[model samples]
Target: MLFRSLKPLLAGEQHLQLIWLALGSVPVVEFAAHANPDALVLDLQHGLWERTTLEAAIGAVGMHVPVIARCAENSHGAISQALDAGAASVLVPLVETAEDARRAISAGRYPPTGKRSAGGVRPLRAGLEAMRAADRDVAIGLMIETVEGVENVEAIAATAGVDYLFIGTGDLALSRGTSDSEVIGRDCERIVRAAAANGLPCGIFTANARAVRQAFESGCRMAVSANDIDLVKEGFLAARKATFEC
Candidate 1:
């Protein structure tokens, strides 16, 4: 609940798309939180991070902006743990059907709305009100990553409690067996349309700022602007060239 409210996103304005910095370490988390992009993405799905890292990152961020955890899978444990550790949002990956979307939603919710038990570390520290407010505060992002996912995009988007529909272009390409630009464009369009029809925002994963901007033009309202490793690599490469080149 410490992360900023989801008012703009919930209000459905074509406002500035949130540029989130992805990170998995304490120092990087603190730096990114200080730099203060739209939000922070903890890459549990693909990043080599454990539970302790996520907890430390959450503490470092301390609600400057939303800290969203992109979980490893679409499961209750994965979804709920991130929420319980005080992630304002959770991104569930590899979702292929409406049921997969539904399961993710149910897992993150409370008893009446979901099966998630109410014992998050942050919530406990904040006392009763935070726990009660959690239902309204937690944002749920469901990823559409496979051919089957694309085929059922509309149904999945229409599922309840889905705050956003995110496209994992890399995984989709792998699943579809081709990385053709045209095919990815078509897929992005379809997923964006699905989210629009369901009154939700759309997001995507991009490797660089050029692609991130292009995705916004293609109707994605948000993108992964940078990750810790990428930033370090880019900085080192630039410095190396500047220092060594004649």
Candidate 2:
């Protein structure tokens, strides 16, 4: 029933690197945890994770490093399931307005602050103190990826109970109907400024180490630099090239 909290890392000024896990393999998650990144994100939205595997993956990595569950949608069921599975934080996607952000926050929190139900196995096993700790520490993050989201970024950032803001750059680019770096960069910068003005940490989904570093330079405290599937592909390609050269 032990839970590792990500609040300490989020509160600091240092840049935090997070590995995104979408393959839904416990071994892959376990290996990522061993790499000791600042945190690991379980992508439930587009990932291959089922309920049992999600719980098992979190169980395997929760003690080693904090886990942030990126819910499939901004809904109570999605948010609660992730928290119940022992994720230290929940990231809700497609948050286009302040109301959307509020809804996500309400879903992630418990009792007076939120409407999260209390029947998860972890809660029952951990008891009152652990539940209280969860209420006090579990972070709720909202993703700003749509044009509407970027338009209302400031209001979304100011929403009470939102622990952080994340930019879904791929979706953002798609929403804006352009892949132009300058256009995307402007929106990212705007979102970062909005988060800073609200005194909250901002994060982004990056393609590589360079993007991650650029995100940090642009005021993002957290960055999802790589995901399991892409890493595996890269590894295979690199190994194949090396073998051929040899």
Candidate 3:
């Protein structure tokens, strides 16, 4: 709870940062955390583990930096458990409407503000103050990936307590059935504008340096670098190419 959430980073001058999405392996995740990325997004949705594994991995990250768990879905229990597991924040994916965004936010916050129950691991270990701090220090991130999301993005961005909107444009492209630059760029620009209108930062899951540059140049704030799989593949290809070509 003492650790600052991605909210501050998103609001700071250094809006550019890396987001790690990986399986719920403690050592592997900890290694990513060790690199001190701007934030690490635990891919629980696709990771090969139950929510319990996330709790263990979060402890392993040990406040290295902001650890955000991308919950499997929009379930209230899942969101509550994610934050309770020590994640500085939880990203609810496929959030398409303002109501969906509101539901996710309500589940993440405490009573009066939300229906999230208290007495997570933090509270038991660090006392009542820690549980209280989760609401304050912890942030909420939502992903707008589908067509509906893009359509109502303006209202979603305006939702209070919604920290930032991370664009899941990979799926967006797939949905549109065309990786056309013009199409993607147009959508990205619209999303950025929506976030800007409501004083929220916009983030993109970047595929490379060029994508990162484009996101920043187009008025976006956060640029989540490529995932580990691509990094490993690119590393291997470069190393192999150097040896063979040289």
Q: Go through the candidates in order and give the clash count of each.
A: 0, 0, 0
Better of 1 and 2 by TM-score: 2
Global CA lDDT of candidate 1, please?
0.81
| Prediction RMSDs, each to the true structure | 1.8, 1.1, 2.2
Quick one: ranking by lDDT, best first? 2, 1, 3
Cα lDDT tens digits, model 3, 62-172, are: 467788888889988889888878888888999999999999999999878888888576546877666776577778989988878999999999999898888888888
Residue 85's lDDT in candidate 3: 80
Question: TM-score for every candidate vs. truth?
Answer: 0.93, 0.97, 0.90
Candidate 1 residue pairs in backbone clash? none
Cα misplacement distance, residue 39 of candidate 2 (Å): 0.3
| Tens digit of per-residue lDDT, candidate 1, span 65-163 | 677788988888888888878888888998899999999999988878889877867778877777878678888989998999999999999998899
lDDT of 2 at 111: 84
Sort all candidates by TM-score, best to worst. Answer: 2, 1, 3
Q: Compute the lDDT for candidate 2.
A: 0.91
**What TM-score does structure 1 among the candidates reach?**
0.93
Candidate 2: 10-residue stretch with minimal lDDT: 1-10
